[model samples]
Target: MQRYFVPKEQFDESGVRITGEDARHIRRVMRMNVADTIICANNKGDAFLCKIKAFEDQSVIAGIESVLTSESELPVRITIAQGIPKGDKFDTIVQKGTECGAAAFIPFHSERTVSVWQKEKSEKKRLRLQRIAKEASEQTHRLLIPEVEPLMTLDQLLIFSERFTCKAVAYEETAKAGVQSGLPSLLRNMKAGNSLIMVIGPEGGLSPNEAERLKQSGFLLCGLGPRILRTETAALYLLSCASYHFELLQREVDR
Candidate 1:
């Protein structure tokens, strides 16, 4: 069944009311009708199998049939803090990162960042990214949508990331020096349910001074791998490694 994320307030004891874009998509785009079954996930990450009860006044009311259970989320919460890159790359980052099980995203202004969010259109861009995150979450059957934060300066990102259990910067220099233990060692030290914030540089990568500042703020300057990866791919790589260590490896241990 197709899935849609409904606002927490829209969900009641019996069912949920889907409104706005989702309702339009259900009624007009998907052409779904009454009695059609769909999966509805609330903001709190609870999902239910629902049957459409009615389409009224730009809304689709669905009655809860049963609770739906799935273990699709990452055990560790990973947030991607990316230096602003050019064009539609950020969109790809948010969409793919959500699919890879990222819990949040932060677009930051690094010293070497070439693209800046213009003041007049910044909110529009942020909303677009938020929407992308939501759509990606629903498509991946993720109960909670990844949060796309407002564009932040380097200082703000550091402060915002303070709540995470661990923070790391994807420094290419470590990768070039044939250092391989950085990322793996960090993973081995991490426990399930920990939150991680990964800072990735934009196209030209972070300046040495910026990287050093992050290190001073207790962020690990870890290399991703032997080869360099584009800014867009770095977060996905980290998330995949985490899934391997925390999910895939643990599955074997359990078996």
Candidate 2:
């Protein structure tokens, strides 16, 4: 079934009211007609099995047939704190990261990050990333739209890591085998509701002193694998590993 996400305000007491780009997509792109059954989700993870009642220029009204709680969210909430990379790689990061089920993203300024976000550029990039996140969320049928938070410094990221139940910083300087290291075990052992945070640095990677500070702040220094991965690649890789371990592995075990 085709799925669409609408804002919470679009849902009235009776059903959902689709307008703007969403209305255009349903009417013209999807070519949806009256009495057609489709899935309509509010931003908060409430999905309704809806049948179109009316289609018009300004709005498309649909009656709620049934509402189901969304099961698309991951068991472990994973947040990626990535050091802002140069060029348009951040777009790739936000899109793929959303698909991999990231809860939130933090683009931080690290020592070696080639791209600098001054006042105006920072807001522009933040807005651009946020729009990418929204599109990616709709494409993936995600219930909650992951946020592309404002840029932070390395120190800020370290401080923020304290909020997570499990926190790890990806550092190439850490003297350990990437996948074979304790990282896998640590991730696997996390309780179902635990929130995980993974930190990925820029092109040159996190500085030694920065890594040490993160470690001192209680973040495990883990390696991705023997071969080094790019900044954008690392964020997706970590989230994928986490989803496989926590969500897919448990589902397989239960069956």
Candidate 3:
């Protein structure tokens, strides 16, 4: 079933009222009609099996059939603090990161970050990334949409790291030094429901001074294996490993 993330106000005793772009997508793009079933998730992260009850003025009124029990989210809440990469790489990161179960994304500017976010176009860029995260969430059947936060500076990123239970930085130098134990050790120490913030630098990667500052701010400098990954690949790699450790591997252990 097609899924749409509807705002809380859209739901009532009768059904859900989906309007704007989503309604257009359903009406024109998907060519859905009355009696068609779709999955609707509310602001509270609850998904319901809804049946289309009516369509009027580019709006879709879907009646709530039953609440869906979705367990697709990862046990751990992982946030990717990615240094703004060039071109459309951030878009790909947000989309794939959402599928890999990232809770949120924070794009920051590091010393080595080449892509500049002009003040004039920052909001527009952020909104585009947010849309990507939302669509990817729905497609992957995620209960809650992953957020794409506004771009921040290194100092701001440090403050943001305070909110996470664990913090780590993907450092190429660490990988070069054959330091492979940091990431696994951090994961082993973390439990379910823990929030983690993984930082990855942009194209040229973080400078030594920037890495030192992050380490001083309590971010672990870890390696994603011995190979050096691109700015976009590093974040995805961390998220994939987190899902395997906290969801797939844990389930096997429980069994």
Span of 10 residues, lowest total lDDT, candidate 1 = 181-190
> Residue pairs in steric clash, candidate 3?
none
Give the residue spans of candidate 1 off by over 4 A.
none
Candidate numbers sorted by lDDT from highest down: 1, 3, 2
Model 3: weakest 10-residue lDDT segment is: 175-184
Q: What lDDT is obtained when candidate 3 is compared to the true structure?
A: 0.89
Point out where model 3 deviates above 4 Å.
Answer: none
RMSD of each: 1.1, 2.1, 1.2
Could you give candidate 3's per-residue lDDT for residues 109-180 as a string of tens digits?
A: 888777899988988999999999999999999999988888899998898789899988889998888877
- Give the whole-model CA lDDT for all candidates, comma-separated: 0.90, 0.85, 0.89
On lDDT, the stronger of 2 and 3 is 3
* Per-residue alpha-carbon lDDT of candidate 2 for residues 63-172, written as tens digits (9 for 90 to 100): 99987776678888888898889999999999999999999999999989888889778989899998898888878888888888899987778777788998888887
Q: What local lDDT does model 2 show for residue 28?
A: 86
Error of 3 at 242 (Å): 0.8
